[model samples]
Target: MAVNTSGRTTAVDRAYSALLAEIQTGALPAGAVLAEVEQSARLGISRTPLREALVRLAAEGFVVQQSPRVTVVAGIDEKDIRSLFELRRGLEELAVRAAAERGDAAVFTALAESFSAAATANPGLADPAAHAGYYALISAYDAAVGDAIRNDYLASALRTVHTHLVRVRQLAKDNPERLVVSAGEHALIAGAIAEGDAALAAHATHVHLHNALISILSSIAGSSQTSTEGTP
Candidate 1:
């Protein structure tokens, strides 16, 4: 949307947040072209700031510049998913271990309780709004771990991985069942951290990522096969 804002950095951040949300939510799906002039006008920002926002996205692999003014969203495939998880698994496992050893017990205890409530009342997640709230809880848990780990470089790397993770989650929107089980899994991780069990926390993170990767890859494989079988 158009905003009357001052400052180049503010303008760029505005454009970046708006575009990133759309891209992650499939509003600006892969292969969609972003024209500088059109986006600049629509976002009510100068072309300079829009260009800067696009450059940030491009660096994060969200988009690619085909020409001076043409940018297209990048597409993800099975290989990309596998690679992302390899990095995620390593980073998150290390993060959880650190968080368990260093995190405030009260912070993780509260989160664990929240996750327990979600696990019990997970049927509510069948609703889109409820699912959004559930994801917010996940984000809060991620931030808490980032804070607890007390490692700047690890947290910074995780921020990049999380950007693409939002888009990756869209791939399995059809499976509310998984979200139900996921709540309990997160509860285990948080509960372990609250109890200062580094091994248990790391193991929980590993299992959660393993299951998530399998589910996503299976979903992609099923969709591909369905498309192939439907071809005339």
Candidate 2:
């Protein structure tokens, strides 16, 4: 956190990464207002670079600026969740199919290991901090699979959607069981790809995304029902 590395990432990049990390881990909760000058002072950076970092964060769906007043943490609602998941489902299925065709054993092994670790660790209840590692592992596997596709259009689309998806993933950090389930799905898809079963890999990817969407919708529904019942 000290930015003490010997000139690797630039100051703005470091600031952006730190802010994004906090947002991803839910330290900066949804709709929290961010003061540019205050953040710059805390990070020991100038306002110019902080503003630049904030702009990048906005592009990544991590922050939103409402002119002349505040820049707040963007809150992801059900609609955004639905859109992101649907896009992820399609692109992930494509990645799975490509990885299957390529038959990448190493990629599959890495994914399998991550999933196994996630399952055994129970990051949600055991160590909430570990969930970041779990998501990073999952992202690495996804990138490997996507790379095998060799389709620029698909790859570009995936990169864009992935940024948005990460923001949505913050919602489930408090639910450790969901993380475990996600790891399981990643393993299944990885297995299918490693075995060179394109159809199965695609199907697995679809089912995985579908289940995530369903879980989110179910959470929203439960909240709605509870509110309705409590109404006077």
RMSD of each predicted structure: 5.4, 6.5
Where's the lowest-lDDT run of ten residues in candidate 2? 223-232
| C-alpha-based local distance difference test score of model 1 | 0.83
Q: Give the alpha carbon lDDT tens digit for every residue of 168-192 in model 1.
A: 7665435666777788899999999
TM-score of 2: 0.72
Tens digits of per-residue lDDT, candidate 2, 33-74, equal: 899889999889999878888888888678987667889988
lDDT for every model? 0.83, 0.73
Clashing residue pairs, candidate 2? 124-176
Q: How far is candidate 2 from the true structure (C-alpha RMSD, Å)?
A: 6.5
Residue 83's lDDT within candidate 2 is 77
lDDT of 1 at 121: 82
The model with the greatest TM-score is: 1
